[model samples]
Target: MPVVRLCEDMKEHPKTSKHKCPVQIISLDDQGGLALANEALSQCLEQGDVGDAPVCLISIIGEQRRGKSFLMTCLLRQLQNQEDKDASWMGSDDEPLEGFEWRSGPETVTKGVWMWGEPLWVQVPQGKVAVFLVDTEGSMDLQRQLETSIKLSVFSILLSSYQIFNILSEFKLVDQDYLEMFITVAEEVGKNFNLYPVQHLDLLIRDWQHTSTYGVEGGQEHLKRVIKDLESLPGNDLVLKVLKAAETQCYLMPHPGTRFTRSNRLGDFEKDFQDCLKDYVTTLVALPAKHVRKDSNGHALTGKQLAMKIRDFFQFLEENHYDFSSPVKMAETLANMREQVNRKIVDIIKGEYSEFVLHQDRDTQTETHCLNISPTEMQKKLEEKCQELLERCRRELLGDEQQKEAMVQDVGQELRQMLEGFMSTYNWRFKEMENAANRTIKDKFKQQYKGYITDQGRENKARLQCCRVQPRKMRQCLEKKGQELLQQCEEELRGAGDRKQAVLRDLEQELTEQMDDFLSNLE
Candidate 1:
């Protein structure tokens, strides 16, 4: 639950005494794996002197081939495009531009370059980091990857469904290997912190780009696909910005435990919250109404007979003849009275309920006010609420599991079928159609014309040559037959020109009439 937010130098985070960087050696297993990893990590951490370099590492953890590389590319390019807006280093005419670093090969350093510089780190204004973006192998083994993943200081889990159904996710979601591993890691994480809806890559930018989707087989197309994914996501301004930023950062590490996240809707620690709500509703219906007026002799009676009788409340009294003046006597009697009648509206009871209700949302405002309560009282009341919430959360989780189990299988099956159909249709044919239809007539014409047309065409050559030879005079040469060869050549050349012009005239006239007829038809 304790997340370490690393700035450029891990300033706010206390440096791990064993190492300069704020690295925690986590050991979720007893196999001495943590110790071994930590030793390696300690060395890695020592070598990593963040310096004043604005760099932070965010690791994407997920099942194999689940769009991790694509997601990373999308983030990187999205950032580059965004950076272009500032009119800075991007697209400068004078300088050779610096393009972002990205590659998809498995052994490629850090699983596709996740930000080569500090552009993304600037988002955390209060913090500074030179991001060393990484995508690890073996997300198939979720537990170990996650334990390793958390070391990145930030991570994200991606799941896709109409509603995130785990079983539906079981097959259609991520690979079985990854799902098992990540879910276990997520559950274990749940034990520590209330997870919020994770920030996943959503890209649909491909829609607007005029480019071919072709690339090396199985190479990254993350930037191209995720842009369109924004449609299904919740439209929260901050969250959307957060996600968009996540894309460029070469990672999305949106934590689930934070407020305003899906975790709020989880209702996990939801104690019988509605009970308290109902009580408040009832109180609003009633008010600070005086109901009981008991005398010093403890022979108290309310005017409303509908309420429980005071004689029944007296049954709580252990000794009938006890000292009335003792504070302890009054306390016992009151306690007994409350337990016995169970219907009396006590002032103390109302006060306790109000306090509990006001602090239900234990956040900034509520927490500040809670300090007013004595530690003991707060603990007792909160414990009661906490227990109720946990119980409710458990019930909800079970109900969700049952409901999900029954329906998710059907949905997952449907989804798998739909995905197959989608792949068949869209991935191949749809893309083919898109590729086919994508060309504009003008574009096709230009492409077709590019090399076909000549600047110094035959007509120009003929025009230049025709200038010195007078057409009428050249025809006259046929009559001079002095050189029989020249005479025949001149005759044929002159006749050919005249015949060609005549034919072209006919074509022009025919074309004009056809165009006129077409216009008339339109009218």
Candidate 2:
């Protein structure tokens, strides 16, 4: 069974002070099969606020028994100091490095991937970021099978944003070959997963022989020489290409004195070694923004998001029964899976768009009265709703830039076409309804004006008869009075048409003429 050593159960060295210990996140079975320690991994990566905050993972990988774990222990101490706000990250002179298990021996201590139980929360310019340290089983161990090493290295590369390639004394051809193979596989995996293959790689060379040259300056000089030498050789193009493409840096360290090596304790570090280590750790942790893990689109990954991705990768491997030996086969499987996911995502977005339109249509039909809205207004609203849906689709999309753009174009075109069709039908219906309304209002106004004119004529005729005037004089009086009534009716009717301005001009002229005729006949 895989063991998850609890923090309290971890053994503390008699001579060194006790501190938090790392838990095995990935364990190897007796048969050398990989198994994810889900409970332990989740506890470390997905708990409380740290899980939701942006995360940075730093992992170290190299040959077996090269102080890889010791280096990680140093990093852990520095981070803890920062978290506690100590006067100096470098603790007391006699403080023993206590985190990852390391001892002076030829045997490998870490068998699989181990992660610090607690995440170090650091505040930077970008805001608080959670940093996780990973220590992988060292590669190129004679006792370990080749497949195990490959799997461990691949997992390390996939999980880490900042990868430290630890070397004993110098960079060598074998190291270059191993790095090339691991990175190539990682790049292939990243292509299908919408992740960055490698963000930052640090080449850490320990126990440098050169006395005058140390630290970053010596590391850069040595790296240039190594690359130049690789260029002169044949069949080294791939490694050279990877090295140049990735964001890489180098750091060289002098041996931590012969006494420290023999004792394998932090207090035994040479004065120069301790100072250099301080400088390295301080610089590394100070620039958290540069190391924050990001996706293919350059968006930072929260701790929860990073954890999900890791789980997804392991799940994929398990489902496919990956043997961890064939990159080509793995890539093929990933390609097939990606195609399926893309199709599903597009289908989902299209369905959502359809549902949204249907809901809007139902809302419009259920209204008790017409909206009195113009086609232009309706079109504007439809476009905005469609744009909102498209934006949501864009956020959920996963793929390379070219693939995402193509999907977006296809989806956008479909939405635009749908909007155009809906608008065309809507405009036609609105025109019909508007014309009907105008005709009804026009008829009502005409009848109302005719009635007023007839009433005025009757009253004038009755008044003339009552006066008992001569017929010619009565006719003159009736004509003059009828003209005055006609002007009054015109002014009253003018205000009613203000609501229906489109037909007002024609209705007004027809009503005026009819009223004038009525007044003339009365005369």
Candidate 3:
């Protein structure tokens, strides 16, 4: 359903010429091509279609201004006509070409990657598989660098299930060297970036002369000899290794001698090439569906996923500055890595900080008495912990120390309020303890005064003659007892104060030493 709606939304307008169609799949800027495949692909995802369907992708690559576009045009036309087996399509002489142009004396007319409006649906053994076509800008463009060309080739190979390597003449040593360069770069890219799959490479030897030696034996032997000699060349064993790993196929075609030179000539050359072209299309369609980049379910990428991946590919190329040769570019990459590490560190510290605060609260809950701590002191502890963590991260992650300091300050401010709330609860508990202690001391003094009065009454009766002396003596005795009671209350208060001070000192020492040890490694 997704693909059906996708096809409907992305269907090409019949009136718009292919060359001028605004919905071109990709376009190039100064840096590289942008994958605009989402224009149609997004609809595919929206409609719940093309789910887990295997897909086969074919891409063409070759030297510039060598009728690559023409070949693509011819190939696409034949492919589209396959659904209508009753009709036969031949190049028109009376009208302008309808698809990709056959431009002559080119200044590299094809700029970036281009794709057919809709993928051709073919029934394979697996199911209905969509065959996607991608046509890239030819290699060795006058305006592009060798690095750019290699990147484009690598990019194309990465995106396709089968890659057509189009060449103007017989395969040469220069071709081997170019492939060796690609192998090296591909290996590196696979290790550092996304790991690209080894796809089937179809070597298309264009403009082959019809000499007797140009037969199957000659072309096959030539390719084998090149591979054999390439093994002896410096650092070419890797190229051979990659070729052996991939499914390499070759096709040799003779030159289309004056096939479309005249306005109305449709000669034997055209007929023969068309027959061969039909066979090529047949072989292409019958080729088993190979999902080079499959999702977890081993299904080919949906339209949306494919579009996004294409975007990421070009972005990857741009970020690397076409190649990782410049020192400035490499430095930028390192900076980006550091920034990523900084973000991860922030996340890790947040978790650690939260867990620590939770444990601190639990520890307070298990204490015998409410801690007599002030809001300012609590705030200082929280800030110190935050700052310690931030400094550690700065030394280890080495990214935006100022920014990290600001973050720590923000976190500290937030936790400052939490600490204040906890301190309020502790203060309330302390107030209750003070009230209880006062009541117990008052009750003890009251009971002791009553006993002293009773004893004094008995003594007064025993010395009745010295009543005046008794009054003064009783007063002195009462005063002494009262003094003793006051001393007892003062001693109890001093013990309470000492207990409070001891608790405070123990807490301060424990936390200070813990924090110091935790931060020592950072220093």
Candidate 4:
């Protein structure tokens, strides 16, 4: 059975589990007059001045059995162990998946405020993450709680393996059946989610999310979309020239001849991402009724079509939190709504890129000149091969590296060890997270307030707003890179990581020796 015990520190090294912070949640009912109650609630939340706590409120909305309860519970688990960076997975054979992987563990956090019918609040890692999961009454029936839902900084629409997009497109399942529910949800998200557009854009470029991104987010067309769409957004136009001139050149990795090379690159997806973002930004900034409606339903797209596709993308962003930020205080998160929009564009590109890699085969047959020569000729080929032949071999090395690169193999092993070490420390943090101020919370609120008030007109990239990072992805990336270099590192680290990286030299000798042995066996 899965371990349901909650611990603050998830990545503990066969060590003590007495550290992690706790998660507190109180559940409330889902039945009530949402319009009236939500209005009063928003006024209270907006004005409460909860001194020590954060003001950001989250509203969880979903159809019945759409894993709403499951997602909420999982989210709470993350919150409970906010300090546990070690909340990682052990090998999947016998041990259970913990934290993100394992839903049921003994680890728990200091519980927070919760309500049943009203709103259940759970903490988030950074900012003031309190999820006000509003449980609906009837299954698959959306309770029109626009006032409360829109007030949230982020909104999520949960789906299970069975659930899909277009709630109204498939069946008319609300009051008056005039898409009143759909329109309300869409407009609220678009408006509040798009607050202070110009200011948010500046923050995005200079503050929360890192500007050094090598993805589509790091390019000229991307910046243009932010400027053009944000400028045209229904609201404000914060930065003009800065947005106009913000340009980027996408590189798969650092320049060629670098120590590390990108395994696979996606150029087309980068362009598509830019195009979609440009179009989306333009639509929102203009806030024009240019969206064509296929049916009488007020949704911009036809029965689950393009015009209304923004809402679906918006929902995805809120759900998975497709935002970016440089923890080093680099980019502005809320300088404009384009930050969120940019993330959507990023997600679309990343998804396509991942597919590009996954769908392609790791193995392929290539035609080669297999000279029908006696053993004598085969020896002559390697012995006589000089500069030109070696260069050709250098080019082939990349393909071999892609297929069977020991550097990647060695790096992968080391990455696992490094990740393990990091996780061990991470789990330790979870145990005593209460001592440290919620860095996540502080960073988030700081960015939000900054994005709200920063000089959007400033063209400098330094004064922008930012996203709140918890070092999760960084650690993961480090681990991945390490894994790729594990084997190479074993030999390199043999001398205590001091020796020059002779990876290509060593691997080539080893391969040549192995091939020579194989060929000689014919004797």
**lDDT scores in order:** 0.30, 0.72, 0.54, 0.28
- Per-candidate TM vs. native? 0.24, 0.79, 0.53, 0.20
Runs with alpha carbons beyond 4 Å of true place in candidate 3: 1-23, 30-52, 83-97, 189-195, 210-219, 261-272, 291-299, 314-523
Residue-by-residue lDDT tens digits, candidate 2, 1-523 = 3222222223221111122568777767777777776666666778777678888889998888888888888788778777644436666667776778888887788888888877887888768888889999845665776667766776786669898998888887778877877776667656656678888888999888865588888888888888899999898876776666648878898888989878755678887787778778878888777888887779988877877876776666665544545555545666666666667777987887778766656655522233446677778877888788777666656655677778888998998887888777776666666666666657666676667667766666677566644446644554554455444444443223554554665666677677567645755
- Estimate the overall C-alpha local distance difference test score of candidate 1: 0.30
Alpha-carbon deviation at 469 in model 2, angstroms: 15
Between prediction 1 and prediction 2, the one with superior TM-score is 2
TM-score of 2: 0.79
Sort every candidate by TM-score, greatest first: 2, 3, 1, 4
Give the best candidate by TM-score.
2
RMSD of each: 37.2, 6.2, 15.9, 36.9
CA lDDT of 240 in candidate 4?
40
Clashing pairs in 3: 2-49
TM-score of structure candidate 4 = 0.20
